[model samples]
Target: MKTILVIEDDIGIQKQLKWSLSEFELVFAQDRQSALTQLRRYEPDVVTLDLGLPPDEANATEGLACLNDILNFNPNCKVIVITGNTDNSHALKAIALGAYDYYQKPIDADVLNVTLNRAFKLAQLEAENRALRSSNVAAQEIIGNSDAMIKACRTVEKIAPTEITTLLLGESGTGKEVFARAIHKQSPRVKKPFVAINCASIPENLLESELFGYERGAFTGANKTTLGKIECANGGTLLLDEIGDMPLSLQAKMLRFLQERVIERIGGRQEIEVDVRVICATHRNLSEMVAEQSFREDLYYRISEITLVIPPLRDRGHDIIVIAKALLHRFNDEFNSKIQGFSDCAMQAMMQHSWPGNIRELQNKLKSAVILADSKQISAEDLGLTAQSSKTATLRMVREQAESQAIRHAHSLASGNLSKTADILGVTRPTLYALIEKYKLLDLRTTESETQQ
Candidate 1:
């Protein structure tokens, strides 16, 4: 139960408050001196202060001083000042001095209880946000110590404080968004919104409206005007994920907007100017797409004034174990499990296997392992690593899987346009055709006729 301190000089009033607020652990104080003592002792989340105190029932000087002292000691503690019915001036002054809310001479128990509950909830939310924020600060940069990883970190740290348009290149699940967040957190615009939109996630038809919002009555369901992601992130950072997947038609419009720094809603004619730091990320190679004319060369250059390529997880030798240990401890707390660490066999499996799915795959695997682990330590079996999986994946197998998945992802991003898919994969028409046939990636085909092209 949360503690509440009541500072009322009247004996009858104190009895009445204690009886009414039976839900909380109530501490009574009749004077400023006693209230301060209780405050220092209990460190209560809330306090109800009566402006009328002992030795000066005619004035609010003592009560006001006590309120100031309470606030001075703990800025986060929520304090409610009780005032006379006609003393609106004192109540307003109390608020100006950081009092949470004020109650008048006639305090209704139910009304006061509502305010107290709200204050407690607000305090709890603020505390959680602070905790989460601190963890975010600790995880501000990518966690890796390898040379390639260090190079990526240095590039991000070097470019974060600037307004330069940057492109993050890497395979899927390699933490491009994490790197983007690190950049935004370190940028001048850190105080502003860090809006992110996945181009590949949203439908091709609605993607335009989502990027640049629609006006009221623009569509059948457009009941109210809406601000797009770009406008919402004004004076902040905007991340366009899977930009290579952005449809061919939308690419031209996006290019125009980037060039002008202004956007017009789907049905709105007026161009709304935006001041956002645009960051683009994709597992697909844009330069190859540019060569094949699927992605506009101009747009690629505009977004990639600087580029940072995150190394694949398999290549970051020792960093895998480092990240895995940190994840184990975090998951331990989250699952309320006492998993000591990885078993020797589990560690061997982790180090040997090619992390095809990268960090995302690793995180999911660990999450399941933590949940399923019966012993203090997690075994390779806990991670679902079979005998075959524990064996090191061959270089050929790794290359084939990576290449096939990359092609399939590009096809999905391009919406099964073979021309665009070939462009995104940086392969000629013949090579892309051969890879698709070789991998049986026809599941990505939109229509059978298109595959023939």
Candidate 2:
């Protein structure tokens, strides 16, 4: 059973509340000292505080102290403060001090019950969200520090605040969906739901209704009113994955919604207003599509207001190795493998091979390797990559490969901190600086600062 602590100085009111709140595992304290003691003992999920306690029965000071103490102990706990009927100022102050809400004196039982119910519901949701976050997959997390990746991160941080339509352009396997989510998570609507739909996955006949929704009896299969993905993502984000494949007919309706912020569900007479951020991702060349009339010229302009190009895995230089190791650690936990790390030959082979499918391919291969490898260290054979037959020991190729591997590993171990990168490479801070100078790593590092109009 969930616990509640009631802190009030009035004996008569306490008895009345105790009877009313008998459904809860309730504990009471008549003063600040006793309240603190009870808080430690019960660690209750909710607290009902009357901001008029001993020594300041007419003031909010004593009650405010208890409120602060409760928050200090458990920031997740919901504290509801009771205040004078006409005084909204003290209630607002309690809110600023982290109280969940305030109830006026001479409290109506119905109103207070509603407020308590809402607070409890909020507490439960917060707990569930925390648990879910802790258990989420690491591959789902962004794990690259290459210049291309950093630039992508910076772009997301900037564009997430605006209502502009965003288009993420990338190769087939580069992580456009991940970047889209990062934008949503950083945006003002982060607290709301984020719904993702792949345009290429749905059949042409069903895509329209899937997005704009349908009315009851609208079609042969429609038995009930349904909210579409757009409506479901109200006040949040909607990721249109493989948006290049969105049917031409639906593109017109999508463009209407983008231009007007309203949608008329299929067979529905009234238009529905929705506030949603649209993030579109595709591997296709949309400009080329516009030239060919395959995609609407107007829709292309709208979605490309802020376009981000995610570099392919081979082009991202050292990021491939950084991403590979991250995938390895994730699979290790999931497959219950005793794999400690990658062997020298495995690392060499990973650096040599070109990643055709980018991060997605790397993750899949690592997941497979972790389950199949028999030894502690993963080797080249385990990764399913073999060294080339015409192996050249040219100094240029060897140094270039070593330098690329060093940059990737340093960034990974340092979590993208440049100063840490210098330290980990075992070169003097200035020597490491000169190496970054002698090599063209600066372009990779500085590319993150670029912004789109």
Best by lDDT: 1
* Candidate 2 residue lDDT tens string, 1-453: 668899988888888777776667778998899999999999888899999888898888898888888888897899999876486877777775668778887867656776787789767755643453343322235665556666666677678889888999998888888888878877888899899999999999999999999999999989999999999999999999999999888888899999999999899999899999999999999999999999999999988888999898888765666667667767878877767566657767887788898888888778888888887677789889986643454445666779977976786677666667778887676776677777767743553233111
Per-residue alpha-carbon lDDT of candidate 1 for residues 1-453, written as tens digits (9 for 90 to 100): 889999988888888888888899899898999999999999998999998777877888888899889987897788999887495978766775667778886768877887799779767754643453355431345675567866676677789888899999999989999999989988889999999999999999899999999999999999999999999999999999999999898988998888899999877989889999999999998989999898988899999999989889999886787678668878989999877566657777788778899999899999999999887677889987743453224445666788988987887788778888899888898888788778887665545366566
lDDT of residue 207 for candidate 2: 93
- TM-score, predicted candidate 1 vs. hidden true structure: 0.56
Strongest candidate by TM-score: 2
**Colliding residue pairs in candidate 1:** none
Off by over 4 Å in 1: 1-139, 386-453
Number of clashing residue pairs in every model? Answer: 0, 0
